[model samples]
Target: MWELIQSNRRKSLILFFGMGALLILIGYVFGSYYDPEAGGVVGVFFAIVLWVILSALSYFAGSKILLAVSGAKEVTKDVHPQLYNVVEEMKIAAGVPFFPKIYIIDDPAPNAFATGVKPENSAIAVTSGLLSTLNRYELQGVVAHEMSHIVNRDILLMTFAGVMLGVITIMSDIFFRGMYFGGGSRYRSRSSSKSSGQAQVIVMILAIILAILGPVLAQLFYFAISRKREYLADASAARLTRYPEGLANALEKIANSTHKLRSANKVTAPMYIVNPLKREGMKLADLTSTHPPISERIKILRALQQGVSYNDYQRVFEMIHGKKEKIIPDSVLKESIAVTPVIGLTNEDKDFNPIEARREANDAVMKLNDYNFINCKCGVKIKIPPDYNKPIVVCPRCGTRHQLR
Candidate 1:
């Protein structure tokens, strides 16, 4: 695991520097369109400053922003006992130093993601749809997958990459709009000679080309990195849970689902277990996909016939993908960590009903919104919405009065 983290950090640094170089180059290109001599230098400076600020935000406050944008509400173990319990089990199995805070998204899409700068300070969020859809074993698999991302530092890497993509998109948009409104008009007219004017035209053409292609190229980089890490996380999940079928089945359910995540954006798509934007039968994502093909992933998981170790996952992964390169390093294999026994479900997991699951998810969300609950003597529970401004509520079933305040 330490080797994986070290390798991940090394690769992350490369990715950040690579994207940052693109950012600076794009800045310089656009700047030259305005001030051919000095604007390029100014643009380089500006790009550096922008990258620094975004990196800072991404490290410190990015998770909060992502959760807010996704409409995630933090909750206690009481919201869904089995979910908490399963998460707890996986946390122990993975040996995460601290319990990741739990969050619930209100969307009905059955997808989940993890977020933090590191594993020690992290949170995992799932949709209400996931709660209602997945069985206990499947839920554990999804949790383990996200937990793998935390342990692998995939969240941090993806966060930085997403921010880079965002910066590129923003810069490209500004460049296009500037061109559309004749922003570079002063360039040619200010040229002192015909050669200088030609150079300006070339610079303008180059700027336009970059503006058109920057985001596309950046996305290719972003998605390429995203797709690879999903495989790693999937492998890690299998190793942690020692139950490949659980994640395989869970992925099947998620992939076959027709509902696209309502709150998902391009930046957040990579964080989800599956591609959040695409539904079944959409354009098959090639290199630009955030996650690997769900079918391929499920196949690799189910193909782990040898064993449930990292070596086993790598063996099957290569056998399926037909690659000689190793996904699991030789050092990781040497650890020779034996698979731990699987954690059996508790009575709470056994007794879980889909209808009850949905209700529990809804109640958890409402609690976040300040909804009040009261139990009546007649064995009826009263749920009062947050906007219920009245001071008292009468239970419909028991005709009992409950104080709101």
Candidate 2:
């Protein structure tokens, strides 16, 4: 698991530098077209600054934006006591400082995901269907897998990669817009006095080609980074739980489920435990995918369950998937595999009402829709429908009336 972390960290840095280089190159070329030496200097600076600002924003706010776009609502222990307990226990096992917020989506699809800038600010969300369908052990396996993502900071790496991709896309758009809008007019005016029309045509042709290829190259880079992170997260999860079968079972269940999550779309699809954008008749190995095939992931986990070491797992993964596993150190692997004691149910549990638990889950889902309150200011908690959109809601806490934004 440590190896996965180190490898992804290295990859993230490489991508950052690669993106910086691309931006600098584009800036220099465009700048030189206007003023040979001075323009190149200015362009490099502009590119660096633009990349830095955008990267920072993505690092801090990307996960929040993703959650909002996916329509996830936060929940508390009172709302989803089992889920909160599971996540909290995993957080302790991972030895992270802050526990990730828990969230529930109304979809019937059995799926879940983890997201945040870092473990401290992270969150784990699951579909209502997942909670209803998965048994306790199976649910622990799923939560543990997502917690692994938090520990390894995969979310941060993904966010950074996304930022770089965004930068490249924006740069490409600017290049194209400049070309189409006659940004070269001043250069043309100056060059026309000293050069032939053929030279001018050559410059425009080269500029147009660069404009078109820039975004394409950026997209390829984005796809490559996204795919790699998914693989790394899978390996990390397996190492963390030390019970690959648990996660494997969860994946199998997700694959078998037919319900599609209503809120999922192309942009937020990659963040899901399963590809929520169900593609009918599509096999797992199709080239156009943000996630690896579920079958492939299960195959790898099953192999791990048979006493395979991390190195051996990597070898098998590469043989089957054609991608190298990031080399994780023994110490990190041991640390990640560490588990906390499970809270065993006692005979006293019989005193608690199962019907009440069901009611709580239902009410929580309903409260989520009426308002996004995970915790109330009045100290009393409430749950609502996932799709409820009333303008006013009475807080169960203190009976205060709160207006929806």
Candidate 3:
């Protein structure tokens, strides 16, 4: 997990420098052609300020904005007791400081994700289909996987990667806009010599090329970073649960599930546990994907279930790609291996008491309600008039019609 964090931080830094350099080059070209006297300084300053302001805004409010855009609604225990219980259990096992807000989308897709700048301020959202489809153990595994993202700070890393990509795209667009709008008119005032005029035209052509290609190059970098983080998050989640079978089974189920999320789009698809966009049949050569291949992920998890270390996993991945494996520090490897799994209820275990779970659930529900209803399975609280001998009861959640006994 630490190695993943370090790798993401390094990538962010490199991209930051790369963007600054690209902006500087574009500014230099623009100044040379249009305002030779002050172009370099103006371009560099503009790039710096733009990068700083944009990055800062994304760092603080990006997660909230993303949740709102995704149409995720905040849920409480009253809304979904089962999901709240699972998330609470996972958060305890992961050693996260505060329990993240839980939410459920109305979509049928079996997908879930975690988002926030930090664990303390985080939230997790899952589809209604995920709840209805997977069994309890499988659901626990999926929730654990998302909690691993929070524990490892994957949300923050991915957010920065997106910001870098966005900045590059903006810079490229600005260059093209300037070219098209005759911002190059300043070039005529820069030089009256024939050679200088020719130089101006050459600079303009180069600027246009850079502008056209910059976004594509930036996107490639963003995708590379995203793919690597997915792998890292998988390994971290495996370590967190210590029972790779649970997550592996969940992944297989998701791949086979027919449900597709209506709210998911290209922007939010990468955030899901599985690609909620349902691109499971796409070929491996489509490397520009926001997610790694599900088959490949399943294979890795199966290997981990057989007690494969992360070092060996990295080696296998590198061999397959024909590239040198990233050498993670021993300390980080040790920490990843140290996460203990939560002890959950099992069919054979005497401790697997449904009654106790129900009691706990009921207690949690009672605490959430201000005025408790005397008779209702849905757990809603409603006041009954004194003259009413037998009042009709309605459950807001399950919608069961009944009368007070």
Top model number, TM-score: 1
lDDT tens digits by residue: candidate 3, 17-124: 775677667656655555655775776677667777877887888778767776776777765677888888888776767888886665556788889877788899
TM-score of 2: 0.75
Candidate 1: regions farther than 4 A off: 183-185, 280-284, 329-352, 366-405
Candidate 1 Cα deviation (angstroms), residue 83: 1.1
lDDT of 2 by residue, 1-405 (tens): 455568667867887788767767777666555554376687667767888898777677777887787678898786677888888777776666788899898777778988997777889999887876665556777898788777777787777766766766676677667667866635555555445456556555665665677667766777666665566666656655556666777788888888888888776777777777855235633455777678887887776644434555566587776765554444544544333322232233345454654555666686565545544686765544446688778876477787766
Provide the overall lDDT of each model, using Cα atoms, as 2-decimal numbers: 0.84, 0.69, 0.68
| Model 1, global lDDT | 0.84
- TM-score for each model: 0.86, 0.75, 0.78
Clashes of each: 0, 9, 0
Checking candidate 2 for backbone clashes, the offending pairs are 3-327, 3-328, 363-383, 365-384, 366-384, 366-385, 367-383, 367-384, 367-385
**Cα shift from native, residue 196, model 2 (Å):** 8.6
lDDT by residue (1-405, candidate 1, tens digit) is 788888898889999889988999999988888788788888777777877798899899989998999999888887678789999999998886789999999877899999999777799999988988888888999999999999988988988888888888888888788778975645556678888788888888988898889999999998888888888899899988888888988899888777778899867777899988865333455666777888889999988755788877887888988878667756777775756434443243467587877787777777777887887889887888877798888889878888777
RMSD values for the candidates in order, in angstroms, are 3.7, 7.2, 6.1
